[model samples]
Target: MAKKKSGKQPIIGICALCKKESTLEESHIVPKFVFRYLNAHSFTGRIRTVAEPNRPLQDGKKLHLLCSDCEDLFNKDETLFSNKVFHPFKKNGFDGPVIYNGDWLNRFITSVNWRVLHQDLQKITTEQDNDKPLTPEILNTLSNAENVMRSYLLKERLNLDVLENHIILFNEEIMRELFSHPHAIIQGSAFGTPVIMNKDAMYVISNLVGILVITIIKKHPEEIWLNSFVSNESGEIPQSQHFDSPIVTELRKFEDFRQAYIEGISKNQLEKLQEKIRKDPDGFKNSETYKRIMMDRKLK
Candidate 1:
């Protein structure tokens, strides 16, 4: 593995990706570029994380996960994704279907899934048994998927094997159900985390504004994820998409949580947010936030 010297002192630890006892780099679970775009377009120029909604974050969540070499390996795919899909989709707000050809999209989604899964496992390791429902078999499956993804990211494995990577656009279909709580759907845009549904499915979900990346580890028999699977070589991200799984119920539950959290925001912070929007009416109107509001209004 290649190494680079930095002015800061290196912190030695077991690197999550390469499994090497070497210097680790602070890695973002979701790439920093996604958070950068969210921050740049937000009225306050800051994001409120799900963990601490009151505290504004300057970037996405990060951890001392990957070594420098592994970080470099992930960056190649991140750059491709940010350039080819993320920027253009965010800029136009999915005006039309987007087509992609090559292996980068698959690799990029897998990298994000791997990071989220690794972080989740790290958390679960320290937690008590109160967090039930994860049977030994399910846990083993999850761990195995993580290993497979890590190997795939390292180029040690050629493909995801049985695991699947899906890109579910938060297009008209899903957004329609969320019309009543437009703000929550808007807030969800910046959210990314691991989701486990019953003993049937374990997946990493990244809501990059309008785009939803779902990487599946365990899939239930009845689950039907339509037109969302990212092909190894080529695929099209169409405007119309459908998701038929218990995951949809989980999503609605999260939207309710977000709505409740939004309702609980302190009056002072709400005033500040209002003031920011007030000062930039034209900018706010043209912003993604405004567009989502309009979309919801039309749906209603």
Candidate 2:
């Protein structure tokens, strides 16, 4: 009785939240320690990519797309939400709104809406020159919002009588305007979309830590403005609300943060972001969030 070493052959496919063909595992739509805490002050801590941002960015962007038992059930609700609410909201900088436990905020919003609906169906099957066609009604509203976030992450349960056509909303006031600007310029665009407006939502938008996470498959009236971060009747996400809107003023553009750092990267990383924007073109052209997006694009 001495012959037991049958490991490594688990790579079949189809387990995007127990759909069940089996064995997958390379997940991570937005949980590589939230891009290692948004590239912990990146000069080169990597992690940038609004398509490409001068290449060299990688804290995590995996996507064989889940099955190590659904990536160990979304790494146990992303390690109970990065050790209790994103490391105490980044060690207490955004200074307010932090009360949760609606079963750990519905298993951390069902593992961030099942990793932004499988990273928007793996960016429409790997961006084939993006004509963006993943549509059979956006794949049946992301497969019924991934079976209601996999029955609230494997049965913690919340069908709440058809959970209002599957609702979900979260916002952090662009993480309190990126902790009230600490010498701004942290644009590591990890995207996720599905918005079909007049109702049919799904927005993951965490350009590392500026959190958004919307979901609402089809039921509008802006979901009663996320009814105070829903989850009551003793579930508890009671207080914590600052997500004013207008998409946080288009994520405070500096020409969409220098076109998310010179789009799709590599012309030697767009000449190192055009030589760091020509050695700090006037400290990134005087940022009052780049003079209010150049006076709102010169009054449009």
Candidate 3:
């Protein structure tokens, strides 16, 4: 048996494809919508999808991770190496921000693991090969490859879809500038509410950042500290879930969250609302729901 390499030298285990973490978007190891059923309100007390590294979405969080490239290229069966991809260095060690993540050469070399890596390759090639079923011998070969390399899952493999509706890319600007091999943090908007660093929907950015974290790191100054923040911004969608939905026990009143939403509403209306709040804190404070939120915030 080959000895497994273990170290704390910042080598990316989760992120293995890209070099630039900045360019590398937060790839979800698991889908976010799945959490909706499990946790709809306040992250169910698990990672709340803050887009910031340290903050958890709500409470109980469960998700498998996926990088951007893996999600985009393979999830959709898109072809890699077809277009010119960027790299920080050709083969030598570098001083500036590297392009892709984690010893790409080494990753490819180490990816000889048959079960995980080979299966992906087979699944992908199978599509092109008329969806041919794997031969018993080949299937057997792919069944056991854990020993070869724990990090052997390749970006471009065959039929590699974990669950449908998987996300590929969450961000791009940072990915191209940073190496995706190291642990990273990303921020974006999902469904509606702001997210700073995300791991629930990263597949399109490429499997660059080994450790991808997404959250709505920064938003309007009024909606800071998060617990008061709402993940859903869509109001037109039927508002049926109760304040005490099983997924979220601590649901903020809809009225309290109105200012935070401006996507679908008119700008003039939003400005008027904002002006009202700014001009008359007392009037805003007098609202029954706002009073309740304040009381909760004080207690929480």
Best by lDDT: 1
Better of 1 and 3 by TM-score: 1
Residues 147-213, candidate 2: write the lDDT tens digits: 6667677664655333322122223333334333312433223454445432354333344353344
> Residue-pair clashes per candidate, as listed?
0, 0, 93
Candidate 1 per-residue lDDT, tens place, 209-243, comes to 76778888878788887678898777787777777
Off by over 4 Å in 1: 1-8, 95-97, 129-133, 182-188, 277-283
The best-first sequence of candidates by TM-score reads 1, 2, 3
All candidates: TM-score = 0.88, 0.30, 0.19
lDDT of 3 by residue, 1-300 (tens): 998788533323443343234233334323333233223322112333323323435432221223455545333211111111212111121223212222332232122112124335434445634554545544343333322233334433432223111111222332223322111122112221111122222111112212121121112223212111111111111111111111111112222233223234456645666786788777666553244345434432
> Residue 167 CA error for candidate 3 (Å)?
21
Cα miss at 300, model 1 (Å)?
Answer: 2.9
Worst ten in a row by lDDT for model 3: 241-250
What's the C-alpha lDDT at position 155 in model 1?
A: 82
